[model samples]
Target: MKKFIMKKKKILIVLMLALLLASGCSTNDTKNNINKLEAENRLLQEKIKNLEKELNSYKKESKEKITIYYIKSTQNDFVLIPEVITIEPEPNMLKAALEKLIQDKRNPFPKDTRVIDVTVKDFIAYPNFSREITKLSVGSRGEELAVASIANTLIKFPGVEKVQILVEGQTVETLAGHVDTSKPLGRNETLISIE
Candidate 1:
């Protein structure tokens, strides 16, 4: 009977040891899982912070606004002339606005005589005013008057840093006998000076 009790005690001790080892192994697995999850969480937080910074920069850039100006001539019955003018809108919007202005019949200039090949790049207005020359009455002082009138008028637009007149896609010697059409024009507030 004593032998039987001794053998039973040995079996119980072995079972307890096995149970303890299993519990220890489970605790180690849980700890490893917790460490992996913590690392992943930290990485995600870093990514979120970087994304927030980029978003803030974009917002700041978006908040900046641009301004532009438009100029028109009184002698030509308030016709819009090509001159150094600042335009407030973006390039696409400026193109659309100019096109709208050209199409408006209420505009003073003759429909066919109007020049619409103007482009605004980097706040500089490139006015292809040479096309209007073909429509002008030949040998008439009207051509010179018209060039000056146009240049003087366009300088009124907002944000126009400068104006470059292109004749048939090339720079010309002069628009009339007075204003030098070779160089790009700066904003001239007074129309009389353009002559």
Candidate 2:
């Protein structure tokens, strides 16, 4: 009977040891998981802070506005177009218009060309061209459409009279294939069709 009691005691002790070992292992695993989650959370917070800083920088840069000067032809003489009477183009609008002009496929000029300058005087509109554009073979309708598009867009401003185009700061030979390159452009009035 004493031997039997001793064997039973040994079995109970073994079972207790096994349970304790299992619980210890589980506790270690839980601690590791918690540590991993903390690291991930910290990394995510850092990323968010960096993104916020970048956004703030962009806003600050855009707030530094750019100004352009224009000259208007008056009945008596030429005058500096008043700064109070100016147009502020949305950044994406001109880019979208250029993209549309290029994607039309029907346009004869190279799609890569850019509008260097756009000026409005006495309700007339003018757009200066890049050297790359002057090298391209543009048609009359294409030039007219380009001028009309810019003029009509600018006229939406308070005191714009018209649009004229120049290439590399100088009057170009012509726009696309039509319209005299030498003359300032008159508002087409029809370009208001662009929504």
Candidate 3:
């Protein structure tokens, strides 16, 4: 489409130049017209270059993808499943990733699981969850899977190296009494199928 428009513009410019040549105007007037057309052509070329550059930049940004972790059962037990998704760059990217992680209802976590708050400092993410997350009855395996899911998801963010889970602003020992939650948790890639 751009090519077609450019062709039409070129033909119009040619017609304009032909008109100027045939008008039999004074030499000074013809020179001014040529200069004016040249300036307009330059502007058009610059505009097209800027548009192409913006288009390439948009394509680059759209191709970017982010990984989110969800709990999925393999053979023996539940594990963290990595899912690739695209999100616009934002200040609250950690919170957005956690929100995506909560969308999978089939995971070990309860359906009402949600991220209440998130903060990052020194490469550590403090992600607080709703009380609904800790009330699941899926046993120790479920609890561990839940923790791994949250930890793995947070670490996918740029600056988050570990995650500290909180429930209503207090760090509990465990979400379901399976894994230790008194400290910040790092990514547990070994728990996943890795395929």
Candidate 4:
């Protein structure tokens, strides 16, 4: 009986040691898992910070400066002059430039005229205007000034070598029956004056 009791006591001690070892391993695994989660959280926070900085920079670039041409009457003749204006950035910057010209008070274009759209292809800019562009009441000189102003303004943009004025999406021969707008027009440097 004494020997049997001693054997039972030895088995109990061995079982208790196995239980302690298992609990210790589980505690170590829990600590390792917590450390891994902390590392992953830190990486995610860094990515969020980087994305916010990029968004802020994009917001700053949202405004653009564009040059618009307007007619300025010289002592004896009319000429086109460039005026730099700030506007909201647009995917179609050529259209934005034309709209600014139409809005300028110094422009001889019809008051009711509107810029329908502008499309570019192969270094040519096509500025489509509303029908009111045909209602140019200003005479021959006014016609020249208007066409030159439009052409010079668009040509200054990159990749725009010439301008083809359109009225309601149709190619027109003239804006006021004076300027030949049947073909694409290049920049008229002669009509532009700095003074």
Candidate 5:
């Protein structure tokens, strides 16, 4: 009876050792699985970041087409010519048109002229310019054409019916002592040459 009891104890110890070894192997497998999952999660996060950057870059490179006016001198006189150009979109399209106009080399505005701001109310667009606008080096006809260039360009927009040119945010009497700019001007189709 004593020998039998000792043998039973030895068998119990061996069973416990086998269970412990099997559990240790299971724990190692679980750890390896967790590490692999963590690595895959990091890789997916990096791919998402890369996709977002690519989308932003594509948005920045996109451009739209708009028609801006430039002065074209004919045999006897000059007229505003419509020129379609590509520019980045702006929240205020009126301001964008004026800025594009100023950027053109053939535009009537004096060199160094800049657009301060543009506001629209009651179908009228008020474009305020820097003091450089007053320095136009043209005669009365040229001044008329310059004023028409602005008025005509803005009038092309759907909601704009007239334009009131301003110098430094105040209503100006005239641009270059020719055309009266104190009041809002309408689109002058006469100044535009379709050709």
Candidate 6:
């Protein structure tokens, strides 16, 4: 009977030691998990704060008015006048400007002219348009005037030094089979009518 009691005690001690080790490991894992979660939460909070700052700055800029340059074609198709226009405010300023420019009935661009996409990188503007641009009745003088007009108008925007016109998201040799548009073009102020 004494031996039986000693064996039972040994079993109890071993069970207690196993339980202690298991609980200790569990507690350490829980602590590590909690610490990792806390770090992730801090990173997310910082990102939210930065996004809030950017939103506030954009809101302020949205209230500021912007001026856009446009081309006003004269009765002579070869001549164009540079005109300045202003709008209250818009998120996409360049897009808005282009929309207004196409609205002018005097320009060679059709009333249905559409801008597919526009992006500015490294001070260059890539304006993708529909194939209607190539459908126009084009002459050397008319092409020169129209191309220069659009290029000059786009360059008026801050940070835009040159423009590369695209059609259906692909580069073209020329918009009207006249000007060499195989590459991006800069503003040509000389094309604007002095008047």
Q: What total of clashing residue pairs does each candidate reach? A: 17, 21, 0, 0, 0, 0
CA lDDT, every model vs. true structure: 0.56, 0.56, 0.82, 0.91, 0.89, 0.78
TM-score against native, each model: 0.37, 0.41, 0.64, 0.70, 0.75, 0.61
Please identify which of the two predictions, 1 or 3, would achieve the higher TM-score against the true structure. Answer: 3
In terms of TM-score, the best-performing candidate is 5
Query: By lDDT, who's the top model here?
Result: 4
After TM-score superposition, the amount by which residue 48's alpha carbon in candidate 5 deviates from its true location, in angstroms, is: 3.8
Name the regions of candidate 3 deviating beyond 4 angstroms.
Answer: 1-64
lDDT of 6 by residue, 1-195 (tens): 999999999999999999999999999999999999999999999999999999988877666344333445567545567666656476677777776666767667776778776789999998888888777575887778667767777788899999998888998999788899879999886666756
lDDT of 6: 0.78
- Model 6, residue 41: C-alpha shift (Å): 39
Cα deviation of 69 in candidate 4 (Å)? 0.9
lDDT tens digits, residue span 1-195, model 2: 999999999999999999999999999999999999999999999999999999887776654222222333347533322122222345644333433443444345567777665554566655566777765563554456555544444554455665566778887666554667676655564422311
Candidates 1 and 5: which is better by lDDT?
A: 5
lDDT of 1 by residue, 145-177 (tens): 444444434444566667777767778876544
Worst 10 residues of 4 by lDDT: 59-68
Q: Which ten residues in a row have the lowest lDDT in candidate 2?
A: 79-88
Candidate 5 on 99-118: residue-level lDDT in tens?
98887888767779989999
lDDT for residue 7 in candidate 2, whole number 0-100: 97
Q: After superposition, how far is residue 2 of candidate 1 from its true place, in Å?
A: 87
Q: Rank the candidates by lDDT, best first.
A: 4, 5, 3, 6, 2, 1
